[model samples]
Target: MSVIPAELDGAVIPGGCADCNAEQHFRQDEPGMWFIGIAHDDWCPTWRRIQAQRAGLPTTFLS
Candidate 1:
């Protein structure tokens, strides 16, 4: 599951192991709509609130 709201406007689609949190892109090519996952890069899946006492980022509503 995603920690941030799925509606995040500026956030490009992410990829890789759910724990890896690496953001990747799906290029339009011979593979059709298949997504290529990136690893060891800039991924921010830390925003998720793990428990009650902990806090999560405010949900961002997109237009």
Candidate 2:
């Protein structure tokens, strides 16, 4: 769920989590469509750190 309205428009959609006030991205694009999800990196430091700590093998490692 999201705390902000879902009608925002911009380079990047904006929103806040329903459980917390952390900023978030509420929209995404595919080949020919748009959908909603919590897919941005706007999470708070606590969540980011937690995610980093639980990371698995790199999906891609390029140089």
Tens-digit per-residue lDDT, 10-57, candidate 2: 234355444445444444343334454454345566557658867855
For candidate 2, the lDDT comes to 0.49
The TM-scores, one per candidate, come to 0.27, 0.26
lDDT score for residue 41 of model 1:
38
Best by lDDT: 2
Cα lDDT for residue 7, model 2? Answer: 60
Worst 10 residues of 1 by lDDT: 44-53
Residue 16 accuracy (lDDT) in model 2: 48
User: Per-residue alpha-carbon lDDT of model 1 for 1-63, expressed as tens digits?
Assistant: 533343442345656546666665444333233334354333435423233225544456323
lDDT of each: 0.44, 0.49
Please give the RMSD of candidate 1 to the true structure: 13.5
